[model samples]
Target chain A: MIQVKDLKRTYVVGKVEVHALRGVSFEVEKGEFLAIMGPSGSGKSTLLHQLGLLDTPTSGEIRIAGVDVIGLSDHEKTIFRLNQLGYVFQEYAILPELTALENVYLPAMMRGERRVYYLKSGIDILETVGLGERLHHLPRELSGGEQQRVAVARALVNKPKILFADEPCANLDTESSRQILELFKKLNKDLEQTIVMVTHEEWHKEYMDRVIYLKDGLIEKM
Target chain B: MFEKFRVSLFLAYKYLTGGNKGITIFTIFILTLVFLQLVLVSAILGGATNRFNELMIDYQTGNVVIEPEEDTEYISDAHRLMSKINALPEVTGVSARIKGVGKIIYEDRSVGATVIGIDPLDENTVTKVNSAIVDGDFISKLDRGEIVLGREISGGYGALMESKSLGGVKVGDRVNLRIGSVDREFRVKGIYTTLFFLVDSSAYINKKDMEDILGVQDEAHEIAIKLNPGEDEEEFRKKLMGIGINEEIRVWREFAGIVELLTRTITQIGNILNLIGLLIAFVIIFIVIYINTINKRRQIGVQKAIGIGSNVIVASFVLQAIFYASFGMFLGFFAMQYLITPYTVTHPIQLPIGPVILSLSNTEALFRAALLFFATILASFIPAYKVAREDLLKLIWD
Candidate 1:
């Protein structure tokens, strides 16, 4: 579960205040499949980053699983990110040197898991993303769609409480986008994996149980 | 935690062996030079000191020579004075001698040579005079009438042939042994070389012949004594200072002033060599480790962003420096042992330097090397800490 109240994030660009998130509020319960939609400069990704503990909100309170991440120390924040949150960036943020299997098990290894446990779990996560046989393949070797799939497997390998995917389908072809949407829908239903995804397409709303639209840093429920 | 260190070491090994091998190899090169520089300095200092001592062997070692109590050109009771000095526990040997200034005459020429009269058997133990003969022989067949020579004096007098005696006088030809205002004919028997300049052609006769020439039936000119090495020559000199004879005390090391200067000069040269070596090591290690840390900027950023501490990264760099310095040390060591040392055996070369600083023997050497290593590691910090403290999320975006 996650909760954000009246979040406001500002940036100073040459003595000018840029409000990326202004007075935004949101909540997602356990096992909820939420899709966040917004145009450019809409603060949708910024909000997701705050929720994933990747960045802290400048003036707001964020609680994940009833613990206030804002009051936590730097080390505590790192532990929370490692154990509870996972990220899948739009650009396929995978280390180029590591193969898909190594990338998937990175979070688990960061959590201090036994190598044997991570080895088997990495295989299972790849299989869940339909990349069972491409474990050793490098990201550069995989297509745009397959690389995104590896990112998804990496996010889920740690069995995080919530998976945050910002623009997961932004770079894919239409058919590849649909395949990714269907894959998320199936994962949400079968594994009860809570996902907070960001997308720009309107018809892709069917992939999630609820949709939250953001305009100019303000949330508009539809 | 142990796994992390193990992984770091594995990566380090690969880095040293693989694409990043230059830094590691350079470290070995630096250490080797330092080790060899130290060993070379030691060998030079040791050899130089020994050479200086050997030169002193043929020259002077008179400590408390006793002459006549009254003003006299020669001591009349030389045998009795020698017995008195030789009886002391501190005295090891004694020589009775007549210091007669004379002209050595050759065919149509004359040269100044000190005519020193000695009891041949007694003088040998005090001076080890026989050992210095490089040509001809010692004053054997003394009763047959012979004279020894010095290498330099033999050249100066135009002396020729091994068997020819003083002034090319034949075996039976007589030469003058002039003392003060008298001359005696001495048959030429054999020629020999010695450490002193005049010994080459100067005649040696039985000591009684010298007493007959000086016209002193009871004594000789001076009695030279050989004291033990540990006996302080100066202290002995001072002990005999006010005894008020025409005699004086002399140390062998004093007469060989040039040798002492040479020993000091060699030590100074050794010091200079060590400083030069240390400077070279510093410059080489600094550039190499700096480049290595710079190249790893991205990797360092990743580690720090992943919650790794700054201390851990610094520890890794320190480990790298130690690996490099040790490699260089042994390399330099082996170079000295197997290469430079053996070559010096045949041809001794002196390195112009001061006394070696021996930094390795003290912590200053490590302090210097470590300071250079830390400087190299710290040189990386500008880039490492810059990336380390940056926003992790932003880095992921990049």
Candidate 2:
């Protein structure tokens, strides 16, 4: 579950203030697969970043699972993110020097998990993402779709309560994108995995449990 | 803390082993050259200083010298004192010298010289000057009027101060020596050179001739002593004092003020070179690490976004730098100690002072290694810290 109140973000470019998110408010229930859709510069990704604790909002109050994430220190926020939140970026930002298994188990390693437990968990999650045979492959060695799958597996390895996907299939082919959307649909339906994704594609709405449309830094319709 | 260290080390190991091989080898090779530059200057300076000290002891002051006591012109009963000193088993040689600053004139050319009176056999045991004869032979005890002229005093034979010496005097040539009020003619028996400018400006003659001219029989200005191998000069001085010998005994080092000044100047220059070498090493490491960190900006942001701490990222770079510096130092030290230094020992470099070999002390090697270690840490930290502390958004996207 998430709660955002009066969320606002403004960027200054050479003495001009650009309002990215202005007075936006929203909430998502547990086990819900939500989507934030908007045209360019509509504060869609900005709102997701605020909710994910990846960026500090100019003026906002964000509570994730009843904890005030906006008020936490940077260090505490990092620990919070590690324990309760996961991220899937557009470029499949897995470390190139690390194999799929190493990248997948990074968060659990940071959590100080036992070696055996983290290794097994990493392998199980990679297998779940259909990357069991590619566990030892590096990001450069994997195809675009395979790399995205590896990123997805890494995000779920820590068993975060909420998963945030910011254009996770933006760089993939049409088929790869379909596969990722289907995987998200299956996860939301079967395992009740809570996900908040930002997308520009209209057909993506069919897979989401709910969709919110933002325009000019505000929630135009939900 | 232990967990953080483990993660940091793991990252460093992975990066070094799996990253660009060319960059890694380049860094290590550059550091190796830097380390070698730092230690080589010190080794050469040490070798020169050692050679200077060796020249002083071998050709001039024979390890220990006993001069006349204050308020006395010469040590009385010099032969008796020589016998007493020679009785000690550690005393390998004892030669009493009657010293005088006099002028030598040959064929209208005159030059100041230190004229020393010595018994050829006794002097031979105390110093290697007799064996350094370049032409003719050393003076014999029975040859009263014959003298041994240093190349500097006799001139020619590649003398450094040729213009300031007696013009071109050769063996069997006659030269007039003037001391206080005594003037006499002596044949130049041989020309010797110690390659040390100060010691090579002196002349040696039979002790009987000097005793006759100065009218002080059985008395001498100083008694030079040479000890057996591995003997300590300070301990030997104490031993002489323990034997009731009331004279001004001093080690060779006390008489080496000029050599000390020379070596100290060289050491200061060596220290400056070493500082420059370390600075170059630091700048080189800093630039390389900075470029690498800049290239990894996106990866750094991704790690941070995925919950890897900033300290871990910075520490991993530092560990990598330390590994590079350690390998460089080990290679440099091995090459210097086993290859370079030993090569010089077998085939000494002919320096102006003498045949010099590179001398690297363990303490100096360790001190340079520690300095380079600290430099490596600082060089790696600045760039890594700067990159790691940047905002996640900028690092990831900008």
Candidate 3:
């Protein structure tokens, strides 16, 4: 579902060049529940962003479902990310002003999808995530676990081929984190989605099918 | 497009009302500035018109002043006095008067004067000088001693140098009127305000009294005619002008350079002020919108990251600016009409304000002001465009 060819990414911070990812290449198949684990400076989130088409690599190319994402225009890349990759950030990117339903429908709206279609798809995603009853509630009104679940619903509403959940449970308490991970695990199994999550929680290992340990930008199969 | 816009609008409305304190506070601030500027413009124009009307009627109306020819002493035929000029469409009414310059001597003091004798009803029917009589009355009772004086003479006697003057005497007093070569006695039944300091030294009575003083039978030294509205006033005067029988016909507007100049300057100043106000309002709106856009850099970045295209995000800001301008203009317009117009109507002389007054009647005044306001809002697009195309990486990292 996702492939990288000697992907290199560099950063310029205060007149100094820092190599984030140097010639890293990897591939992940469809319906795989993969967790990318790494310590600080391991470029875990950066790699995830590159894979999700949120960040462009400096050299080489990233192909998702046979399309090279690096060559896509800004607008095309956005649609690719919207229809193919769904993101669940550590801090829920659920807009505070939006209700749970609006938040879930936001990505689809951003993609300029039909309202009737997105509404139905959004409802289904919310139902699957067990947030169908709380669709009218705002993010602030929802529990942390519920808010994270709404973010998940938003990601999956467009029926993205893959989900990139980057430390989604980092801010949650142990119970909420367990519940969130359980929801993700269940969705991964039931929906057969290709999810590549980036996180460092050792306990989260139990919920995943396999893990890719990233050290110094190199993916080591573990 | 509509659905996306509707969704964005819903989110904006929700945030505006529901604890999105930054945008809410910012909107109110913008509204206040726009309102303040609009009020200032309306007040200036309103006050000037009131003052001009009072000044015009008192100093220069019935505007045609007919003087005698080099050889002819007085206009002999009352029938033909303004007949030729009155034939024009602008001629509303005419009044004839015989004025004789002389010295007015009271018991204790003697002052130089021009004795003006007018037909009481005719004078009133032509010029609105009757409106300025702040004293006893218009020359209703034209007995010998009845006279009107200007505030300038009234000041000489420690009186109120305002609208009215009775020479420190009551309604029924004795005024000694004398012609330059012949002395004439007239009874003062009422006092009127002449409004002009020069005219105040002259006393107004009946033509019968002037005929007695000048000893001229059925004749007047000057003929005054009031022109009607919507008459090509200058052309009308020019057609009847050079035909002045030993005299010339003059339109008040022709020699009214001071009033006209003052009026034009007032209008010009008003236009400039309105433009300046609009410019300031626009700049303020632009800056405010720019700052709001800047503050939302993070939100912009997040939207871009989540597949919200650059064009869509920028279009949203443009839409928001248009929203602000439309709302601001409406609020500003209403505020100016209600709050500022009333004040200006009542207080004509607000110091630095004469210029704006003249613009009140200008045909294009309101339209230009509106145009200026809208133009200012349109100029806000420059700043909005700049904000829309800002570097995404700079926003996310910064």
| lDDT scores of the candidates, listed in order | 0.66, 0.91, 0.68
Clashing residue pairs, backbone N/CA/C < 3 A, model 2? none
Q: Tens digit of lDDT per residue, candidate 3, span B300-346?
A: 66666666666566556555655555566565555555655555556
Question: Among the candidates, what TM-score does chain A have in each?
Answer: 0.97, 0.98, 0.95
Highest-scoring model, TM-score: 2
Could you tell me every candidate's TM-score relative to the true structure?
0.59, 0.95, 0.74
Q: Score the docking of each candidate (DockQ).
A: 0.15, 0.78, 0.40
Better of 1 and 3 by lDDT: 3
Clash number for each model: 24, 0, 11
lDDT of 1 by residue, A81-198 (tens): 7678777778776756568897788667656678899889999989988899899988789999988998888888878888899898999998888888888888888888899998
The digit string of per-residue lDDT tens for model 2 on B1-398 reads 87788889988988998899998999999899988998998899889888988888889889999998999889999999999999999988999999877898898899888899999899988899988899999887788998899989999988899989886898989999999889999999999998888888999999999998888899999999999989999999999999898889999999899988988898899889989989998998899889989999999998888888899999999999999999999999999999999999999989877799999999999999999999999999999999999998889999
In terms of lDDT, which candidate is stronger, 2 or 3?
2
lDDT of 3 by residue, A1-222 (tens): 888889888988899988888877878889989999989888888888788877778887788899888999877887787678888887776777678998788778776778797788788889988988998898889998889999888888888889899899998999999988888888888889889999999999999988888788776656
- Pick the winner on lDDT between candidates 1 and 2: 2
Off by over 4 Å in 2: A185-192
Where model 1 places Cα greater than 4 Å from the true spot, the runs are A137-142, A174-183, B1-382
